[model samples]
Structure formats: C-alpha cells, structure tokens
Target: MSTILVTGGTGTLGRLVTERLRAGGHEVRVLSRHAQPYAVDLRAGGPGLDAAVAGVDTIVHCASAPRGDEQAAAHLVAAARKAGVPHLLYISIVGVDAVPLGYYRSKLAVEKLVGESGLGWTIVRATQFHDLVVRLLDGLSKVPVLLLPAGVSDQPVEVSEVADRLVELAVGAPAGRVEDMGGPEVRTFPSLARAYLRATGKRRPLVGVRLAGKAYRGMRAGGHLTPEHAVGKGTFEEYLARRF
Candidate 1:
C-alpha cells in the first residue's frame, strides 16, 4: 500500500481525507500542529517535514493559510521533490481565478506554483463548504442588521463529498486541474440567511447591499459556478438540519 500524507489533518476537509485514506488500507500520516501524529509545521518546513516527505508516495495538501498559501505550497513542493515523492494533490477554492478577494488570490498563487513545480500533481477547485457558509451567516448574525451583497449566490458543497473525491484523486494518477466540484444546487444568500434565521430562531433585519466591483461582477456573472460540474449530493438544508 502507498503512504499518503494529509496536511491540515485536523481541519474539516483534511480530517475526512485522513480517515478515507486509512479506510482504503493505505498508510496515512497527518500534518498538524497538535500532537496527534505526523505533527509538523507546513508553513515552516524542517527536518521533521523532510522526513515526513521522505518515501511518501503522495501528499494530499489540504492545509491552507490565508496569508501564506504560497509559502506552505513552496515548502511542500521543495521537500517532496527532494524526497522523490511521486505525487502532490492540492485542494483549492472555486472561482479563485475569477474572484478578486485576497484569500482567493493567494490560493490561485499556490495553484500556479504547484503547476510549475514539475512534480506530478492534481489541483481540484471545489465550491464553498456548507459549514463555512453556515459560519459566515453565524458571524453576520451577530450584527443587528445583516448586510448581504445583492444578486450574488452561493453553491455550498458537502465537505465529506469533497473529501471522498480528494481520496479518489490521491489513489489514482495525477490529472492536472480536474473538473470543478460544486453543490447540488445554487441558492441565494437571502434564502440561506432566512433558513439560518429559521434554524437558529433569531430575528434580524436583512439588508441587501448592492455592489459594483469586479468581485461582485464576477459572482453575479457566475464566474465561480460550474453547473455542469455540480456533483455533490448533500444539500445545504440537510447540512443545517444535521447541526440541530
């Protein structure tokens, strides 16, 4: 069996990826700050990380930092190259090329570095996670009035489904920038907010904030969505229901 390294093993997507790889009878090593197993700082690669990459068949890079995506990817790529690692799989957000947000920009930078790293790799751009969408509204709910960008929609994918796909990619050969993964359906934020309000029993006035920037323009034009590639099964409604 091949040995696979899962970075961000404690995070939502990474945890599931670790479990799936182990379930498939493959040896799994988790990269985390905490003391579970295979703990190493991907942001700062050293001997521990060097040894981790040594003899590793594949690395499912699920770790991400908003301000340091490129640095972490560069470290992994260098170490993986030095150790003769066969493959590196990276998870990225959908619409990174189209979105103007700083986080997305960093993710895109990482994507470019991986492609040019000359290592066998696969880059999968997935839609926003259901948990993240819920948490976004949760943070906005703290305010008396929730302001949302008008005409922008969110397609929330199941984190577990994305994990399954990542495992599938890891076990197989590297296919460069495979098809994008998205939710079963795309829904507006207002509907999601109303659902959140109903789910949490909170009362707040909803305000639609109009936008006129490239970010909003891209979102409005559906630059981030791939309806033809929408393959996730779990719906956002079910995701919310499971939380209660």
Candidate 2:
C-alpha cells in the first residue's frame, strides 16, 4: 500500500478521504498546523515537512484558507516540491472560472500554481457539498428571513461521493483538470432552501432578492450547475431523506 499524505486531515472532506484511504489499506499521514502523530503544517517550512514526506508517495492537497487568500496555494506547492513528493492531487470547487467570487478566484490561482510547479498533479473541481447546503440554510435562518442574492443555481453533491472520487483520483495516475463533478440535479437557491427547510421540518420564510451585478446575474442564469458531468448518485432529496 502507498503512503498518502492528506492536508486538512481534520476537515469534513479531508477526514473522509483519510478514512477511505485507511480502509483501502494505505498508510495515511495528515498535515495539520498542530502537531499530531503524523502531522506537519505546509506553511512552516523545513524538517517538520521532511519528516511528514519522508516516505509518502502521494500528496492530497485539501487544505484551503478563506476565499480571498491566494498566497496559501503558492506556499503549499512550494512545500510539496521541496519535499520531493511524487504525485499531488488538488481539490478545488466548481464554477471557479464561471463565477467571479473571491473563493473561486483563490481556487483558480491555486490551480495555476499547481500547473506551474512541474509536479505530477491532478486538479479535481467539485460542486458545493451537501453539508454546504445545510450551512447555507442555517445561516439564512439566523436572519429573520432567508434572502438569496438574486441569482445563482447550484448542484450540490454529496460529500461522501466527492470523497470517493478524490480517493479514486489519488490511487490513479495524474489527470490534469479532470471532469467536473456535481450533484444529480440542478437547483436554484430559493428552491434548495425551501426543500432543505421542509426536510428538516423547519418553518422559515425564504425571500429571494435580486442583486445588481453580473456575478449575481450569472448565478441566477444557472451558471454553477454542470449539465454534462452530473455523475453523482445522491440527489438533494435523497441526501435530506438520509439525514432527516
């Protein structure tokens, strides 16, 4: 079995990937800011990383900062190269190029760094996760009413499915910019929120407000969902049924 190093091993997606890798009989190591049994922060250079990458064959980069921070990607790439890791896999979001959001921009910048690093790499851009749907609803519920920023369509995929795909990518050869992975169906913000509310048995009023900008308009025009690559098996309704 190969030794795989996962960045952000404690996160929602990273944890699942680590579990799957372990289940498949691979030696798993995690990179975190805090010192764990097999942890090293990429931002802090030197032997800490050397110890982490000592015998690892693959590096799955799942760590990310807030939406606007582009420098983190450069740091990660530099560390991986310095460590002489053979294979690198980067997890990114879908619609990063189509949408003009700060997070998407940051992701795109990272993609560039990975490409130029001269490392054998694969970049998998996935849709918003099922957990993100719940987070969005919770955020809206905090306010008296749920206000959607006028436009934006999302095809949220199950986190488990995304994790599975990442694992597959990790095991296989480098496929630069692989096909986009998304949920089974395309949905609007208001509709998704209402469905989520109904699933959770929460009685919250949802209000859709149009914002004056091309970014907002792009969302409303269904810019986020990928019609050609809707490969995920879990539907929004299926996800809710399992949870609620």
Candidate 3:
C-alpha cells in the first residue's frame, strides 16, 4: 500500500478523499495547519513539510485558502519535487479559467504551478458542491428575502462523489485536466433558492438582482457548468431533503 498524504484532509472534500483512500487500504496522512494529530502545517512550508512529504508516494492536494492557494500550490510543487513524490492530484473548480473571480484566478495560477511542477499530476475540476449552495442559501435565508445574482447557473455535485473521482485519479496514472465532473442537473439561483425555501420552510421571498460585471456576466453565461458531463447522481432537491 502506498503512503498517501492529503493536504486538506480535514476539509469537506479532503475528509471524504482521505476516507476513500483509507478504505482502499492506503495509509493516509493529512496536512493541516492546526495539527489535529493526523496533520501538520504544510502551508507554512519548512522542515515540517519536508518531513511530511518525505517517503509519501502520492500527494492529493485539496487544501486551498482563497487568498493563499497559489502560494500553497507553489509550496507543494517545490516540496513534491524535492521529495521526488510520484503523483500529485488537485481538486479544482469548473470554469476556473473562464470565470474572472479573484479566487478562480488564483486557482488557475495553482493549476499552472502543478502542471509545471515536474511531478506526475492530475487535476479534477468539479462543479460547485451542494453544501456550498445550501450554506449560501442558509445565510441569505436569515434576511427577509433571499438575494441572488442574475444569470447565474449552478450544478451542485455531492462532495463524496467528487471524492470518489479524486480517489480514482489517485490510484490511476496522471491524466492532466481530465473530463470535468458536474451535477446531475443545472438550475438557476432563484430556482435553487425556491427549492431551499420549500425544503427548510423558510417562507422568504426570492429576489434575483442583476449585477454589472464581467464575472457576473460570465456566471450568467454558465461558465461554471458543464452540462455535457453531468455525471453526479444526487440532485439539489435530494441534497436539501437529506441535509435540511
């Protein structure tokens, strides 16, 4: 069994990936900032990281801070190269290059870093997770009306399903920028907001306000969705029912 190190093992997708890898009989180590026994702060980049990356066969990098993702990826790439790690896998978001959001731009930078890092690597770009949609709705529900951006379409996939794909990539050879994974269906923000309202019995009014920006227009153009590869099984409604 290979010793696999997970960068964001405590996060939503990271935890799921760690579990799947462990179930498949691989020894997993988590790279964490808080040091929860299973992880160390690989984000800081020092002897701790050198120690952690040493002898690890594969590195599944899922830990990403919106502002620090690029730096973190650079750190990982350097460490992976120094350690002579075999494979490095990254979980990215769909439309990262198309979307003009700052975070998305950072993600694109990291993509470049990993690609040129001189290690065998694979990148799995997945659609937004159901949990993110729900979390956004939950915050908006606190207000009298749920406010949403106009022309934005979301395809929310189950995190565990994405974890499955990442694990599959982990076990297989690197396949740089493979087919994107998306939710079973795509829906507008107002549509999903209404579904959440009904599910949670939050009788809030749904409002779709138009915004002026290239990013907003890009989202409205469905830059974040890949309908052709809607391979996720769980629907937003199903997730709402189960979660709320």
Q: Pick the candidate with the highest lDDT.
A: 1
lDDT of each: 0.90, 0.82, 0.88
Per-residue error (Å), model 3, residue 197: 0.6
Tens-digit lDDT track for model 1 on 38-151? 678878888888888888899999998767778888999999999988899999999999988888889999999999988999999999999998899999989899888888
Per-residue alpha-carbon lDDT of candidate 3 for residues 150-171, written as tens digits (9 for 90 to 100): 7788999998899999998998
lDDT of 2 by residue, 1-244 (tens): 8999898888889999999999999999988777396565555545676677666788898887674235656666677787787888999888778778777778888888898888899999888898888887888888677787655678899999999999999988888889999888888888898888899777877777868866666667666678788999898888889888
Determine which window of 10 residues in candidate 1 has minimal summed lDDT. Answer: 33-42
Could you say which candidate leads in TM-score?
3
lDDT of 3: 0.88
Better of 1 and 2 by lDDT: 1
